[model samples]
Target: MSAKTNKGGAQAPLLGSKIKLHIEKLAIGGAGVARHEGVVVFVPQAAPNEEVLVEVSLVKKNYMEATLLEVLKPSPARREPPCPVASVCGGCNWQHITEIEQRKQKEQLVLETLKKFNPTLQFEYLPLKESPRSFRYRNRIQPKFKNNHFGFFARNSHDIVEITDCLITEEALTTKFSEVKIWAQGKNSKDLQRLEMYISEEGSVRYGLITDEDDGIGFSQVNRFQNEDLVQTALTWAGEDDYPHVLDLYAGAGNFTFPFAHKFKNAEITGVELNPKLVEKAKSKIKEKRMKYFLSDVESYMRRAVIGPEDLVVLDPPRAGASEYIMRALAAARPKRIIYISCHPVSLARDLNWIFAWSQKLGTPMKLARVQAFEMFPQTDHVETIAELRVDS
Candidate 1:
């Protein structure tokens, strides 16, 4: 069977099928995996060791997709979801699981992904960092506006849900949501598509218009509490410097670079971002002595420019992982230290594989010094990870 099939055209496996299968693990997108007759079925909202009765949504040659219908037996890690709209809204995935259990699950996923890529790799399970505030911690949120209502879209569907308050966003944003909703209700303008809320490091709130041409949604971290933890953790790993030359790749609006400049007064910090408007904003915010901002993709800058060995590179790439070209260029540059912050652990593992591969080709392998996970999105399956690698001297 092909992966693509018209919905309702084919009758999927029935919901009451007494398939007593043990869930072995979780897929990257938070689906539970269970094998039956050598066929793997992906079930959402399921946990390891769960026995569920699911209705197959799609059947492919190798695997099947299912929506959980009945939980015959629940896993010990499972917990009641706090948000009423958790299952309906696609914003969060692991809300049904306990916070500590969620962290463990994410950590396991990271380790499993790494092991899959590098069979010989072995590392200690670093304790996952808990967010200072689990709920209402997000500093930035992109709420979609559609169907004459303002709210987040249902998971995997375009149907907009009317949300009274988002449990994960800061109280201020949730409080301001009513105003936006009222404005959207009255206005019939087609110009506004989505609203992005940004709360800066100094606790300043700003709103941005997400448009087709540009995303000034800038580099502000999503989870406010975790963002602080991540920044401090990254800076600590960056180490004390007399005057270290810092290269911030994919640096959106100087989120890290601006604050980092104050810590290292004599350091030369260069921030590179793709958005011109954000770059301009970052430049304006620069009152420090040794900081520069550039509006260019990291790959283009690395391929054409000359980098010194004394420089330290900080990369916070998108979820799709860093481009191969950029990875190769960074390997060639051989910076003293590379602090990589990623939202998607799977992509981070993939990019780390490339970095390690390229470094080995250069005859100087980089050491994976530290790996830290942050609960940026509580009540969800998503996790933010930061990995630090140093060039083996």
Candidate 2:
């Protein structure tokens, strides 16, 4: 074999070898993408546009993973992470990067993911929406309790990283950490008990255990500051067009459903959710006779419902995105407009691809009208995106 050739007659780098790489950009999981010997290397905690010295941690047939050892050159977007435990904790992955760069990366990633799925697609991509607050903005947080260790899980491990304060959490919630710690320590149960703390809509701070019988706040917007802008944007994009009904799928306590109902007073507002608790909550607030909340999965609801061409569908699904059946059904039904609020870009792109492909097959091609990324989550790789799809121009 030649000096640089492997047993398979292909060039491959030795594992545990130290190599210099120029980080071209950040990857989906908060890693820096660099190329070495025509193979991509993903280095954790590295910045884009920087030359970094990395140690090969793991090698694969096609790609390799590495650990950042030293920065030969730093990117302009690099910044000092404020969190003391950011490097060790799993709560955040992008805190070391600048806020401006974080949004830029998120925007680029969203578009890239979409393009990867729909190569020939073109849509009006809007400028990214920045979060109202970058730090101390999260109103809800879950701190673990095990042997009096009150904090989040460590990076790639179950071991709890003890923390008295979380930088992303609200000051009010952080102030209650001592009281919560004491409460957790007082518990006789030695097993780990997950705890929840959040500021309620009534302006009261509430804390409780996440029991098997009750899932504490299954889904919610951590950053309420940005949620206002998100809600307003969704409502505005939905527009004042009169439709027969406004259908909301995966509606958690009528977050967007109620707002859409409020705007379109003449249309029947129907919210479908699998979670019984959220459906109950949404039903309880039924002041309007036209508003209705159904306790069923989106797929199940769509199976029976006859979605008209004039109906407006607003779906805010989980990170997994809507199921394939739901997407295909929506494509066949061809609703007038679809406002999709997504948490994971890859899942969103996959779902969109399914819908568009199916619509094209059905001879009713729904076009992607607009898309915008929201910095709902700051100091982390997580991002929220809003996309609008319509049947006609």
lDDT of each: 0.78, 0.90
How many backbone clashes does every candidate have? 1, 0
Tens digits of lDDT, candidate 1, 1-393: 222234654334432344456677777788899876667888888887777877777766677778788888898877777888888888888788788777787778777777788877644457888888878877788887765678887888877777989898888788888777666666566543577876765777766557777675566677756777788888888888553688899898877886677676787999999987779888988876678888898888887766677777889988887877788788878888888999888788888888889989988788788787777777777878888888876
Clashing pairs in 1: 94-381
Q: Which candidate's lDDT is highest?
A: 2
Model 1 backbone overlap count? 1
Q: TM-score winner among the candidates?
A: 2
Q: Per-residue lDDT tens digits of candidate 2, residues 268-366?
A: 999999888888888999998899889998888988988999999999999889988999999999999999999999999999999998998999999
Structural similarity to truth (TM-score) of each candidate: 0.89, 0.96
Q: Give the 10-residue window scoring lowest on summed lDDT in candidate 1.
A: 1-10
Q: Rate residue 191 of model 1 by lDDT.
A: 46
